[model samples]
Target: MLVGDRGSVSAELVIAIPLVLFMLLAIVQFALWSHATHIAQAAAAQGLAACRAQDGTAADGQASAQQLLDELGRGPLTDTNVSANRTADSASIQITGMASMVIPLLHLPVHAEAAGPVERFVPDLAGGR
Candidate 1:
């Protein structure tokens, strides 16, 4: 009569492999999310820069952002929306989109916004009496 545990290691490996794979998938998803966020932020910054430049327009900002996304955001971002707004003193750009799903059936939202004052010459104030 032999009493021994022969399938313990194999069973453990079988159970642990899937868990490890899931963890790896989660890590990949997080990396994708981070990359998407950085791309969005960069796009927003570029748009803001365009809009805040001298003689810049909101349309120009929007176009700049859209171009960046179209060029660099192929696999990681989808359904992108770019908006640019300019006030009397400031300009802002916003990029919004959905991040690619690394996990099955999961969708993540990503957004980035950048704002700055429009560049203009301010005359030096002379001596006040």
Candidate 2:
């Protein structure tokens, strides 16, 4: 009988397999989280842009934000809240939502904000070379 060689490989596998699988799952979860975060930020930015647009009102911005959320997710969105604000020279939007993971029993709460200067430009209609 060997001192430490008997079934050593099996023992190592038993210990290492779960650890490796856990690490892989954690990485996958993190990637999902990061992607959700980006989607949240993008939704907020789209809302803010819509709010700042001259053709649309705040409700339009909110609707756009909701559309963005829908595009980023499968099934229906949960607990979505959206708002936008405008000043004499500035505009901003805030979006809050929760994204459910593809895997059961997993959910990620997302909150984001987007703001930019509100400017109206008038281009010269006259043809110039």
Per-prediction TM-score? 0.90, 0.73
lDDT per residue as tens, model 1, 61-122: 99999999999898998889999999879999999999999899888999999999999877
The candidate that achieves the highest TM-score relative to the unseen native structure? 1
Cα RMSDs of all predictions?
Answer: 2.6, 4.0
The lDDT, on a scale of 0 to 1, for candidate 2 is 0.76
- TM-score of candidate 2 relative to the true fold: 0.73
Residue 62 error, candidate 2, Å = 0.9
Clashing pairs in 2: none
In model 1, pairs of residues that clash are none
Instruction: Give the alpha-carbon lDDT of every model.
Output: 0.92, 0.76
Clashes of 1: 0
lDDT, candidate 1, residue 69?
A: 93
Rate residue 24 of model 2 by lDDT.
83
